[model samples]
Target: MANIQDSAQQLEEAIRNSDEFQNLKQAYETVMADEVAKKMFEDFRNTQIELQEKQMQGQEITEEEIEKARKVVETVQQHDQISKLMEQEQNLNVLINDISKTITKPLEELYGAQEQ
Candidate 1:
């Protein structure tokens, strides 16, 4: 367990230095430096979080909110920098998910992976 913890820390450091993380970080900085893009991104994120929270809380979100969120998404997707940031985010997410699967492979083998 101690060895695994040490390896985990090393893996985390490696991931931070990885191309995916570096690209994501650079893309994020580019988006944040543009005030208009930054504001747009923030609005999109806030709207998404609000909707997700409402769903999690079992609250019925109105059609207006859904339409507004859709518009926000559409507008943000039009910005090049914001779109690059989103793409980098997805790239990083894929890397993280792949790593997760690799780390959990042993457990899955031991318990037999179930078909979802």
Candidate 2:
């Protein structure tokens, strides 16, 4: 229904204006402002994506690749701005997950499914 579309848009705007989203944006900007932190964060993210892609493609992940990813994560975790950014990201993910569960309640009710 058109009303549902409008409600969805309102939810989107609310999410965009949420504290979690704002904090995540600020933290991301802070990390990007520092060249070293940005590079380290990018490398870490790329390593994660590579591993996830391999997993999704049913390809074997080499021990060397795992070790490399671990090292990249460690290095990135040592950077304050990047660490802050990662924390904010986690917070935002939690908010999104909560919102998803809330929105899916009708389906759960229809199916008589117990809340997880």
Candidate 3:
């Protein structure tokens, strides 16, 4: 377990130093440097958090709330900086997902259903 923990820490460091993470950080910084884009992103993020919290609580999110989120997304999509940031974010997400799959592949193979 200690060895696993050490390896996990090393993996985290490697991820932090990866080009995908660096690109995402740069894109995030560029978006944050623009005041208008920053404010818009904050609002969108807040709304998303609220919606997620409500869902977690088994509460219904109103259509108006959904529409508000959609409008915010549409507005943000119009900005090149925000667009680049989103693209970088998606790329980072894909990288993370790939890492997760790689790490779990052995267990999956061991317990996976056998094909007919």
Q: What lDDT would each prediction earn against the true structure?
A: 0.95, 0.91, 0.91
In angstroms, the error of model 1 at 7 is: 0.5
User: Model 2, range 25-68, lDDT digits (tens) per residue?
Assistant: 99999888888888888899889998999999999999999899
Off-target runs (Cα >4 Å) in candidate 2 are 113-116
Highest lDDT scorer: 1
Candidate 1: list runs displaced more than 4 Å.
113-116
- Candidate 1 achieves a global lDDT of 0.95
Ranking by lDDT: 1, 2, 3
For candidate 3, give the lDDT of residue 79. 83
Taking the tens digit of each residue's C-alpha lDDT, what string does model 3 give over 1-116? 46988999999999999999999999999889989989988887898899999999999989999999999889888988888999999999999999999999988988786744
**Candidate 3 Cα outliers beyond 4 Å, as residue runs:** 113-116
- Which candidate model has the greater lDDT, 1 or 2? 1
Query: Pairs clashing in candidate 2?
Result: none
Model 2 weakest 10-residue run by lDDT: 107-116
Q: Any residue pairs clashing in model 1, and if so which? A: none
Output the lDDT of residue 95, model 1: 93
